[model samples]
Target: MTKKSTIKVEEVNNQIVDWLKSYAGHSKVNGFVIGISGGIDSAVTSTLCAQTGLQVLCVEMPIHQATSHVTRGREHIEQLKKRFPNVSSVEANLTSVFDTFITTVPNNVDAGKVNLALANTRARLRMTTLYYFASVHGLLVAGTGNKVEDFGVGFYTKYGDGGVDLSPIADLLKSEVFLLGHFLAVPQSILKAAPTDGLFGDDRTDEDQLGASYDELEWAMSQAEIHKSSLDFTGREKVVFEIYTRLNAVNQHKMLPIPVCRIKK
Candidate 1:
């Protein structure tokens, strides 16, 4: 039997719509801008923003993106614009930009961590593109990061996916975001698509990089706060615990604000 969500989907939708409108009104921004990655988090967040009846600029900045990823993004945007006149889209292919940066930034230094660095660079490029549109149109960039990525494991890149004017689903777990996606009637393709960062080149998923499923990671994170019992974790459970703590510790820097050197007067 499928377990029902404790959250009332309908009520949650309405409340979030109201909050989006009220916050945008308070900020006096023209509309909300979001990077539509064809994933549940972005799809759900975009739907919520559209529900507010505000102008939403969903940008698809593909840099060496897979064909399927681009197709999914466009399909969702087509549906979004049909349902909400305020929803609009723009495409920014950052391939040349990234290529230029890669060649110049490293000065051909041959760094071993180039792949990971390039992945984060892709995110930052998208971030720059979103902000460019936001600044030109007087919009605020709405982040699509969810709780597990943002707070649990810090899976987002600093000043990349992590940089945004607002984060609508940052409080919701990955499972909860899927729930909201279903409730929002997000594109079936998006709802069914496997969750990925779209940052890694070889089309690796968050699970591939994280070494555990979101459910296990979430469970492990929840247990991190409680006292551990020797019997609490079995073989796989113990592995999950170790993966969670290791990732949590390494990504601690990503979770917090940049450290500043304190000057003593």
Candidate 2:
């Protein structure tokens, strides 16, 4: 069974719409440019931006992306266009661009490190592509990261998927994002699909990479807030807490602002 959120969906939805509209108004940007990855977070974010009646440009930057990801992304964009006249779409196939970068860069490094770096490179390329569209259209690059990724585990790349002009749903957890997606009528294809970054160009899921389910991670996040320890739990709960603390500690760099050297004044 799906867990329920404590938030009032109707109220939260309206608040996000107002927040996006107000931010765009104050920033004096044309609208928002988002990278739609056929995932729940992006689907919900783009939908919220559309509800503001501002121009929303949904761009697909596929760098060896899985077929399912592309299909669902297209489906969501098409449905969103039908529902909101102000929403539009574009496609930027970065497969060749990714190839060129791979060949140009030195590959004498370790294989595992290279693979991970290349996966992050895919996201960085997409980030560059999104900014390109945003600049051309005088729009802001809207990010799709949720609270779990932005705070809990730091699952996103440093300046890749993590890079954005503004975030509409960074405060919401993954489960909360799913709830908001349902309330916004996000396509079932996305809402039903397992969450994946689609950067590795393989079938592995976010759970496979993170070593835990979002539900488990959410519970861990809550428990961590109370300064709970493994002594407070047992079995899988303890195992999950360990995973959460380990990741949260190691990824603090991504979660915090970059440090600068202090100088005598």
Cα displacement (Å) at residue 150, model 2? 0.4
TM-score of 2: 0.97
Ten residues in sequence with the least summed lDDT for candidate 2 = 1-10
The most accurate candidate by TM-score is: 2
lDDT of each: 0.87, 0.93
The residue-by-residue lDDT of candidate 2 on 1-265, one tens digit each, is 1234698888999999999999999999989999999999999999999999999999999988889999999999999999999999999999999999999999899999999999999999999999999999999999999998999999999899999999999999899999899999999999999999998899999999999999999888888998657788788988888898999999999999999999999
lDDT of 1 at 209: 88
Q: Write the per-residue lDDT of candidate 1 for residues 1-265, one digit (tens) a residue.
A: 1123377778878888898999999999988999988788889999999999888999999998888888899999999999999999999999999999977875454564787889899999999999999999999999998887988889999999999998888888888888888887888888888888888766788789899988887787678788355256778888888887887789999888889999999
Residue 177 error for model 2, in Å?
0.7
Q: Each model's number of backbone clashes?
A: 0, 0
| Global Cα lDDT for candidate 1 | 0.87
